[model samples]
Every structure is written in structure tokens, then in C-alpha cells.
Target chain A: MENPYLPYPVRIDEIITETEDKNLKTYKLVFLNTDDEEKFIFQAGQFAELSIAGQGEIPIGIASSPSEKGFLKFTVNKVGRVTTHLHNMTVGDIMGVRGPLGNYYPWDRMEGKNVVIIGGGFAFTTLRSSIIYMLHPKNRSRFKDIHVIYGARTPGMLLYRDELTEWEKRDDIYMHITVDATDDPDWKYHIGFVPTITDQKAPEGNADTYAIVCGPPIMIKFTQPVLDKLKYSHENIIMSLEMRMKCGIGICGRCNIGTEYVCKDGPVFTLDQLNRMPKEY
Target chain B: MNVIKIDKKTWTEGIGRLQGFYRLIGPVKDGDFYQFKALEKGESPDFSMLNTRLSPKSIIYPQSEVMFEYSLDETRDDCHVIKEIQVEYSPQVVFGIRPCDAKAFLLVQRNFETPEYKDPYWIRLYETTALIGLACNTPCSTCFCVDAGSGPFNDAGLDILLIDAGEYYYARVNTAKGEKILKDSGWSEETETKDAELAIENLKQAAENRITARISTDRLKEKGVPDLFNAPFWEDVAFACINCGTCTYVCPTCWCFDIQDEVRGTDGVRMRNWDSCMYPLFTLHGSGHNPRDAKTKRLRQRFMHKLKYYVDKYNDGIQCVGCGRCINLCPVNIDIRKICEAMNGFEPEQKSI
Candidate 1:
């Protein structure tokens, strides 16, 4: 039996700093072994544990679409010991990754439905993956209209600016970008918090609409009510959770809200499911 | 279906004979309390005690176990490659373990050997060991095993069940492993009549009758999750808790663990250590957010996971084996029996918010 805890080595091929503070960087990793690449298939909302061996390991959501093959991408924030070590690495440095763990977003459930994605800060990684997946030419016709509401604390903190710019130019989807308050003359997007912009810009919810929200806990706490006021039922609103995880597998008991292990049962759950779980998370 | 009798006078001889075939482990006096340890050349188990301070789980699932080892020597051809450390699985017998402790292994096995994933380290050790349970002829004041799906003489998870019958030990061999141990020990004496079986049954009944404590778990499943999470009694129950990990460390069925990597010079080993939910760090996120940071929430998580979550998830009884180690060892004397009864009997009030 293969050890689930063993991490496969991968080399960083490219690194892009997404924030002005240089705290968040997107790394494109190519597995050292081709067999590992063939075995690592994951959906948008799933996460992987990135490690620096002697330092430690931390769970980071996959930031690139699975439809784009050959390499994996992770957007990391330099917050703790592991992340600080990860952010200091260059293009050729090798790191460890163990994953494709946890359940993904309910893409099949949202097929042919009008989709709305709401994101804030660095929490936009998985939501970005989902949006890119849905907009891919091969899968484009499967869904109806798509809308995105993303924000950060300031213009300097906004991630994937180039991609957001490209997305804004496209006629296929509606993209609403914002910041809490910004003085940048080049800032051409809306200016407000995520919840306020979500209420003002997001399409009114209906039975055919599926809204997926991902952000800080405070953003999620405030966004749920806006969606509810927009007449979104518990079943139609989806969100991805963030929890401290060790083993991406279900064995480590830290990520459980009730009986459910977030690493296994979800990083993604419907608002209806969240309503049934304890408020600990 | 084999029955053997070993006289008290020749018990050492029986142990000596078994030592030739397998490594022996049993409860022995450790300082002021008793703990399960590997028996040495002349050590014998003290069966006079009701239960050991800690369960015999470490014999199979050790508190800190190494899973993989790697070297970072630059000149070596296979340097930096993580290789599994080969563990030798030798046949061993855990002798004189209480019936409740033996039964706890079966409950823990459900988590370690699940359908989707099998923990190789835990499974390998578990498969190579044989459990020889000693029937509890004298129940402790805190024992409630009878109300928790295991009685004083429960044979659900034991390979062999031994009852002290005054002059000799009356052993009921339940598995092929148990039969082999008896056959190889050279301590067998056929039962001449049904007298031994009748005496064992009467002793089991008497032992169970001494247990006056009971906990109601039937209503736990019927209660709503939100109601249980927002119960008013949590603050009162958790008031005295000092956040010490004694309960989880001494628990028979608490299986939570944390993985860590240790490096020394050029060599490194990845290991897992027993972690408790009572610690605030257990659920602390990397971004400085802790969901169960409060003492009341941590206390609720411990009991809720044991009494409510495990019951709902496995569709079985509570995760506790009712060995009462936590009750006996808690510095603050936070009794699980009282807390369980409070949870089981709670009637939720509608949230005004």
C-alpha cells in the first residue's frame, strides 16, 4: 500500500508575484516524475498540502484549472513558517506536494444553470479555477450566463490582475472587480466591500441560478445574508471553507465541524449543509 | 471450542512456556499506578487490579511512530528520496488486558481500517498481536462498561477470555490464535465437567451487578446538531476544565493524531503523534484563526465527538469503552458520566436570535 503521507517532489517552473507587497506568489510546478503528473488529477475546489520537508506542510488550494494540463499551479500567501519558506524559493527550487484531496465544487449540479461567483482577497484561488474551467472552450456551452464579483482590501492586494483584465475584456461573462478603498488612478473597477458590491452587482437569485462564494470568514458571514435577501435558497448557495489541515486525508481530526471531515467530505459545501453543521468553522 | 485450566501454582510455568513462542506484554505496577508494558525475563502481571491506568492501545497504535525515513547526503545516489522504514511484525500476546480495553480496539479499528483508506502502520501491528482478556471479577466504582456495549466479561474483541476460578484460570479460547497459544503453552488440562463454565458465568454476573453507574445515550442521536452545539449547559460543564490533555491521553478510543517531520544532521524521519482536541492549537488555522479556541467549545468537541458524533457517524454506540480512566485521573474531576447524562437528557430551547 502506498503511504498517503509521502509527498511527491515537484520543481517550480515559473513564479509570478500577484500582490504589490510580494506576500502572495503563484507558482507553476512541474512534477519531477511524469507518473506523478499522470496520477494527479483534481477538480477546481480541491486542495493540496505543500511542504518544505524540514520546515512543515500547509494546505493550499489549487489555483489553476484542471483543463490546463502538464503542470499544477498554487497561489500561496506568506503567512506562517511553511508559507514563508515556500515564498522564499525561486523558479528551480524543488518542493513537496501531496494531494488532489477533498471533494470539489458541484460543477455537475450547476451545469446549464446561471452561475454567479463571489470572491474576496486571496480566497479567489479556487473560485478562479472554477471560472476558468467553466469558460474553457470545450466546456463553455454547458453553462448559462456567468457573473463574478471579486474584491481585495486595496488595489495593490488584488491577485491575478492580468487575468482579471483579460476577463473584463471578454463578452462571455460579467466581471465586477473592487477594493475597499483605492486611490490608484488606473483603478477602473468598482470601489466597495465584497458584500456591498455583491448585493448591488450580482444578479438577483432564482431557482435556475447557483451562486458560489469564497472569501474570509467575515466576508462569508456577511455575504450569506445578502444572498438570502436576494432570494437565494440554502441549496443554491455554495461556499468553500478554509481550515487548518495536516494530512489532506480524513484521518487527521482537526478539520471536522461536526462528524464531517472538511478534508474528505468537503472544502466545498452548500449553504444547506453549512446550516446543519456546528458554527465552529 | 478448546478449554484449558492453569493452576495458580503453575501460572509462572505456563507463562514461561508461552514466552518461547511469542513476546509477552501485560499490565505491571509502574510507580504508584499500573501500565501495560513488555514483560522482561522474570516479570509477571499483577492481575489483582481492576484496570490499568492507560489502555493497551500503544502496543498496537503507538503514541509516536515513524512511517518513513530519508537521508540528505549530497554524495549518495538515492539521497533525498523518502523510503519506507521496514517494520518487523512479530507475533505477540497482550496478556491479562481487561475485556473493555480489548473491546476498545475493535472500535478504533473502524477508523484505522476504513473502506477508503487503511492505515498500514496500525493495521500491521494489529494483525500480528493476539489479545488475551482477563474477566473483571471485581468492578471498579467508576466502571460503566456494561452500559456502553461491553460488560465485565464481553468477548467481542478478545482472542481468549480468562476467568479467575480460585485455584486455577479457566480459559475460553475463542479464535485459532487463542487455540494455538494454549496448545503451545503446554498448560492445558481438560475440564472434567460443566462446573467451570457455571462458575465463570456466575462470576461474570456478579461482576456486572456491582456496576451501579449508567449513562443514557439513546437520546443523543435524536437531538438536533444545532441544539446540541448551542446547549446552555456547556459553560457549566466546561468551567473547571484546565485544558489538560489527560482525558485524551488516557482514553481507550480517542484516535486523533498529528503528523510531524523530524530532522537530525543528514537523516530525517516523518512521524505521527497523538493530538488532543482539548488543545486550542488543534484547530488553529495558519492565518491566526481558531474555531474551537474557547474552553467551552473544546470541551463540547471532546464529549460531542465521543458521545454524539461517533454515534451518528458509525451508527454504533459512543466511542468510549467506559473504562473510566479519564474520570479517575482528571485533576479537576470532570466526570464524563455526568456530562454524558446531561447531554443525553437535554431538551433544546428554541434560539431567540
Candidate 2:
């Protein structure tokens, strides 16, 4: 229910660089206004627009969990003009961050349900929010089962390497990762695209099960069919969307398909809501 | 029933008196067409005329406007908010608006000042703008305002109504704001009958004769099932459409808008600009999926919305002023009236008047 249009100035205390994938990275930032932290918290599955003076702006997901308040973290990819400069930044660089914008996975509705997490390539940035929220100790019993099927192109391209290892150590969550082709001799998770792994896993799906997936457009297209075979109803399957978002709010027409505004009605939606949307996305 | 008449010479004085109290505005003859221009010391808007090239909504909701400016300081976290103070709007009088445009302007109020989504920019402009609906002395062939529930002398969405009878004119106050302006303008008095009726009847016949085309919409609700969504009858109507958004742009009630946020350094202002559904890019997703991709499907969406969908939702027909701007502006001459006629083709002989 937060206003997508209002953006508070968040100070970037520092920026962290993760992954040598050349196209993507993550930044850990701390809000300068301590008071705003209490009021300015954002949910996982929500995103913020990061901007630099004269350099341009881009949408980056809050890779850091909402529960971890004071500091803000963004897992971003250097796709276009703004993102390219974003990757070249130092720790003290000032950038504008607006939002916890768009709808997040409603955990209240998602509780007591089998939760499936799907991530592909840099699109995994959006899922990092949900992944952390599910892994949080306080919210563990709300979900029946937590499963993550994440994939990337190669070893160096994989994001959140340290966190991925730590999360995998926990017995409560199931983490399965795959890569298109891995050169690392030590690597032994899986060796195919995400969609292939999804098809092979064929997780059980019922009315109570929820599937959340994000990644490259191709991965999303392929994985949808796999989830369908699992008996996951469209209403129970959730996904995040990406577009060339300018105003991280619904006011900008660029991120809309018909009456649906990606920044307002959702960046996260059940497949049921997605069905009502014009097939443009 | 007061019948007061004045010469065309007194028109300038009347308008000048309006200029003394308000930011007086009305339609002025812009070559062959008319446009809403501010009334200076002595400017009486032409009453008997064609519609304006641009809508009066431009006055409130401009084509493009800078919302606010932002400045980024590399050292600071909070953005430097550059407050934009627009020029003060004088209490204004919008004179000589056609009945169709009046209705269109009235419809715009919801998007601007609705309880849930009140736009301060649109509201500020609307607060100072007053409308004076002018009767079309020689109504155009394409005018179906009456069918749309507004007409040559329609006063549904006006603060004041004016009807032209040859050399002189008749005026009726519709709102308290309009009544106040009338007192300030020192108009003789509003008449009870005859002059307004004579002008209305003359224009009505002129409107009907010019609009030789007809379509039955009462059958639309009965037959516009999902199966009829892609009927073959669509091709004939869509064949002439250019997809330039002229229909939507000139339309009095089309209210789709696009939001834009521009951040230069650390500072930025978000803006909401007008948008149309006709554009293919509007519905295309980042995943490269498009539902209403087909031109035929989009074309159907446009007419169906006018005749069926919006009606179902609002309990009112999607507003079309029937000003015929869509007809005249369409590149291939894809007339809306023609489309309605084609819709009737879905189940022709069965419907009766």
C-alpha cells in the first residue's frame, strides 16, 4: 500500500561489487537518514530506482532482505547506459533510490504453502528478496517447504556466491543450481539450463503450492511449461516482471500493458493476475 | 422566461466586461477551424463554428509539462527538491465551448480530482477554468452529440449555455460560478424559450442531414459476446484506420496517461503524460510477449470499448462526443459511425427500432 510515486533520498554509504559476470553486480548501501529506515523499509520482491547525477538511472532489486533494515543492498546488472555507469561506481558515490515500489509476494497468502523459487541469470536479483525473506528465522514455520532452483551461465557468472553457499548449508531450504556450461573443475551442482532442470525436477504442485520464478525472458518462457506440468495452478504460481522502467511508479506508461501497471498493480503477480494482463509482457 | 437580445456590436463590450474580472477564454476562429484563445480587452468568441483543433483539456492538462526538478549532490543523500511554482491562475471563464467539448471537459474531472487519485496539477488548472457551452449554429454532419446524450443546446456539462439565433444570442447560467460570471459580464438576461429552440431545431436538422450514416447500438449488448470479438465485419471498419491516435487525442473523454520520472543527478521529478492503447509498444512486455498485437484485435478493442466494454463498466456508454473529429482526422476515413454500422452486421435483420 506504499505510494509508488514517492521516493525518499537514500544515502549510499558504500557499494559492494559481486560477480565478475561483466554484465551484473550488487551494491550494499546504508540509508543516511536513520529515522527513514523505520518508515522506509521495503519488502523482498520489491525494487528501487538507483540514480546518479548526469549518469542516468536504472531499476535494481533490493537483494538485501527487508528484515535487515539500516543498510540497503541492490543486486544489479549492467545492461544499458545507466547500469554501465552504475557498475563503474565507488563506495562513496551518491545515487538516488526510490521505491520498495510495486507489489511484493504477499507472504500472508503464501504461508502454509509449498514455495518454489526460480532464478535465472541476472533476473535472479528479483528473487533474492523473496529467498532471504523465506530463509529468515522468524518466518520459517509459515511455509510448508522452501525450494530454490537457480541457474546461471558459468561459475563466475553466478551471483551471491558466498550467500548461496551459506544458504545451501541450512537444511531447512533446498537449493539446486545449474549452469549452461561450467569451466570450474570443482563445480558439481548441475550442468544444464534452468528450464531443463525445472522440467526434470517436476515438483509437486497443488492449490496450496506457490511457485515464484524470475530470470531471462527465455528462461521464463521455458520454465512456465514445466511448472504447468507440476499441476501448479496459475493462481498459485507467482513471478516478477522486468521492463524498461523509467518512473519506478505507475505514472510512466512505458512499463504498462493495458490497464496493468508494472510499477503499481505489480512487478510481482500471480500467474492468474498475469493472465488478465494483455499478453504484451 | 426573460427574452433579452443584443446586437453583435454589444458582444465585444459584454466580453470586455468579462475580461475585467477574469482570465476570459473562448474559441476564436483560427483560419477555417476554431481554437480556445484568451479573450483580451475586446474578444467575443465566434459562436457559429467548427470544433477546435486542440481540446481545452490542454489548458488544464497540457501536452507536456515539467512537474518538478531534482538536483543530485554526490556528497549528500537527500535530493535537493527544486519546487516549481507555476504562474498563478486567475479565475478564468472558458467561453464559446461546443456542447461536445463541454461534455469532454466535464469527463476529465474524475481523472484529475477523484477521491483516490487526486492530481494536484490537473486540479489546480480545473479550479480556475469555467466553461461556457456554445450551441452549434450550423451543426456538422458528423455531430451525434444528441445520440451521446448531449446536443446543439445540451447543457449537461456546462457552467453556462449559449445559443445563437442569427444576429443575437441567448445565454443560460447552469452553475453558480457561471451565474457570478454572468453578473460580472453584465449580459442582458437569459431567455425562457424560442431563440434557443429555433437555433437548436435548425442545427438538429442540419446535423441529421449531414450524418447520412446510421448504426443500431441497442443490439450490441445483446450480441457482443466474446465469440463476436473477431468477427469478419471488423476488417471493413479497421481498413481505413491509420492508428495515429487522432481519434483518442481529439476525443473528449479518452484519458490514458503515461508517467515519466526524469532524474538528472540526484534530483528528479515524475511526470504523467497522455498515452493511447493503439500503440503496439504500450502492451509489449519485457519478456517480449504481446496479447493485443494484431492490428485487427486492437482495432476491435477500440470500437468495442466505445460500444460495449466501457458501457458495461460505467453503466454509461464510453463517451464519444460525436463531434466527428475522429471521422475528419482519420487517415483512411475510418468513420466511427461506419464501425457501429458494421457492428450491427454481427446480427443485422433481427434488431428493430
**How much does each candidate deviate from the true structure in C-alpha RMSD?**
1.8, 4.9
Predicted candidate 1 versus true structure: per-residue lDDT over B211-285, tens digit per residue: 998988888888877788889999998999999989999998988899888999988888889999999999998
On a 0 to 100 scale, what is the lDDT of residue B287 in model 1?
83
lDDT of 2: 0.70
Summarize candidate 2's per-residue lDDT along B167-247 as a digit string, tens digits.
776666677787787778777655646765665567657654554434456655565344355466777666666677787
Q: Candidate 2: where are CA atoms >4 Å away?
A: A1-6, A28-42, A48-62, A88-90, A244-259, A276-278, B1-10, B71-87, B112-116, B166-168, B188-245, B256-315, B340-353
- Taking chain B only, the TM-score of every model is 0.97, 0.84
Can you tell me the DockQ of model 1?
Answer: 0.58
Report model 1's TM-score to 2 decimal places.
Answer: 0.96
Clashing pairs in 1: none
Model 1 reproduced share of reference interface contacts: 0.53
lDDT, candidate 1, equals 0.88
- Give one digit per residue, the lDDT tens place, for model 1 in A56-174: 68899999899989898999999988888888888977777888888998989999999999999999999889989999999989999999999999988999998998999999999
lDDT, residue A44, model 1: 90
